[model samples]
Target: MGHGWRTLRRKILTPNVSATYLETRGFRRKDRESQELLEKVGALFLAGYAHAVEASSIADVEARLGTIEHRFRGFAYEGAGMGYGMLDGLPFGHRHHNDDFLAGPAADQIYIVYCGIGWAMARLPRFRWPKAESLDPLLRWLVLDGYGFHQAYFHTRRYVHEHYQAPRFPWPDDESRAYANRAIDQGIGRALWFVGCTDVAEVARLVRTYPAARHGDLWAGVGLASTYACGASRDELVRLTELAGEHRPQLAQGSAFAAEARVKAGLWIPETDSATKILCGQDAETAARISVEMRPEHVRNGALPSYELWRQRIAEELMSLGGVSK
Candidate 1:
């Protein structure tokens, strides 16, 4: 059984460079039911992809993508397994083996993976949604080869990407097509809001505005409140968005709607990595903020660092070899 588990791990860890091979691999499930569920969702993804391909125009493809989005949203928000409602509601942010931390009923990890995929897929063809048929291969790739990758990615990559490279858009971008792609590549407008840089007064105001019991989606609010952290006036905020459109085309196109979504939700706004850097060097406030904001008590209390911790651990190791302490 140990050897079998090792084999399973190997298969999962193997690189998935080929789309064809990805189409045929079986899932690693502890039960018959999970295997069946996997198959069902895989079919749904494929059908949606095919529909997007068959659609007549960009609008039609978007409509089909909308159907896929709606279905995935149902899975994300309402499905019995691994939905956003279930994951976001956990108070402690701790995953229990008996409680479905990485797998099983509370598939928060998987649901997040799917949501990220859906978000990106619907915005292909250089961040433009692809024709329906072109999407099939991508969907198939996701279900077969991409599943484990996403599982690991959410646990680790999501934070860095969110902070360093990724931004969630509530809807489509408005910029000219050419500019949007480059901006995303250069890492514009992607920062997680709650990483401890917020002013205490602001935190207090927000907590008072939202009772602790309802702060489960607090990160969403962080994005909305960001410019305030920068002390940007309303006009400045609008100017920043315009600057993003003019200079960082990718960010302007893709993130405007997402920023608006956060704004509408009464959430705080995103503070870029540069803003974070301002808070990171030589001050107690910066250290405290990094410790508290990027990692809360639940995360800091763990025996093993989460995925992000491990990455940092490796960097620390290399730094030590170079006789530098970061």
Candidate 2:
């Protein structure tokens, strides 16, 4: 059913990979570029990931990642889109990372790199259970949520896990993490519709029930699933965004932000842009616009995914922005 629905979604929602199709979703495409540069970087990462995963040692994976860390060091994958990308460069490992790959010594600030690794660690596991398992789930949550997404991403391998020892945040009125976390996970691709289909007030009330730090992630997930997966109408998108923004503007902005980048790149399946746009908002738009020029000439580039190339493009764009740091 999941596989079949995925197919139907592409046909119905993505029907085409052009600006016209995107316009239906309120994504006004402002650009295009050669697929060349995107492929080269993708190839490099794929090679890196393939080798990293094959190794028996976590040390080997980090060693392989060390060679390519510089490429994405500045790529923005934080906030609502935290850990959505970088799965290709960071395979799971048994022990915590060996900080040598980073430009400087590791600190909590260096969580960006760990966040990238953690994202790959979390999202990629659904592909083959226990196959690439390395990083501890709690630790992965720690690094990914080092900024505060654990509210939504926390879970046990078979069910949700509890953290009795971690610092605690007050829950909203009477809401509990158990109720919210399970709902968000179950709502993965359908929460937005579920709120209306089920009970808007209950869902909205639930969103407001959690502490701000964690609830933002739940709201962000709702915003993303509601906006992108449901093929929401412009009015619906606006309403959903408004609802999510009320609790978490960063999460509400995700779908549009991702949609804008994917539309510009002509990608039906986006990468970090899916959620990064939620947190970065207009900053994502500006970076995506600049990414077009980053595309190499078709004749010169080969075998890479255009979406990955956009990160390099945005990295360059952000450098020019002068005030913001991802």
Candidate 3:
């Protein structure tokens, strides 16, 4: 498409910047610093999205995203991934944008990219959704994670407050369909971090409101968000570990996954370092190693997908460490 048309497309597709404000979303505003930090994250994401939609090539998008600060660069790539995914889902646009981007600039940020595709899924019609089989078998679940985050972030009343779950998600036709809600819940758990403004007590209360059976996955989500997003303080992270209680193993697993994601993308920051140390009882590299070592080789070997098995193994590994403690 021409530059003019692409600019117009970007303008039409991107949400207003204010949509991300906690106040605008009716989400909790714990304090000025926390709200500003989270809002900046949203701004970076939108900026990345705009770059992707308007760029002429993958190189063009990369050039723009490269300018983002090291700490927030991964999120920019994530937003770019969403832009590409959204374009691919459009009826008249190129169909291979997401694949090409993933093959090129997004190779290291694969986890964040897949989750970004889930963000696209939230915006597109069901028919326009990508085939689940097209994604890596072990990582496709991250797309649902992205979707869950989007739902809980934007539709808080339904997905968070009302405890709404997608009844029979239709994408990715497979036996794993039954486990879809759990994956999405993991995303919801992640969203709770933002929803509660990284308030450990509030986030814990929100999780507690859900049924007991769902707490494990939910706590895992919190761990991932807390570690990856880096909003909670050391004391708050300690409280999070304390609040996690029996689900500490799952929480640690999530922290490890977050460590893996940030380290793999070369986007490790001080906040991630602190969060991992507090939540996973290990340094970032060690936590990341645990995640890698525990990853399952076969995607379809068991009743659960390799993704869940990977998470389970990581949780088991952390549990052996006697779980994270204040």
Best model per lDDT: 3
Off by over 4 Å in 3: 323-326
lDDT of 2 by residue, 1-326 (tens): 25455344324322122321222322122222212222232244334434323434445544644454343322222211222233233344232323332323223224334434543434443342122124322222223332222222223211122222233322111223222232233223223223223233334555564455555445544554443333333344444445654444434333333444344423333333433343334333443454445544432111222322433344444335542232
Ranking of predictions according to lDDT: 3, 2, 1
TM-scores of the candidates are 0.22, 0.31, 0.97
The candidate maximizing TM-score is 3
The number of clashing residue pairs in model 3 is: 0
Question: In model 1, where is the ten-residue run with the lowest total lDDT?
Answer: 137-146
- Lowest summed-lDDT stretch of 10 residues in model 3? 296-305
Better of 1 and 3 by TM-score: 3
Q: lDDT of model 1 at residue 158? A: 38
Tens digit of per-residue lDDT, candidate 1, span 88-137? 22343322211232244223234223333433332233333322232222
User: Which RMSD values do the candidates have, in order?
Assistant: 22.0, 16.4, 1.3
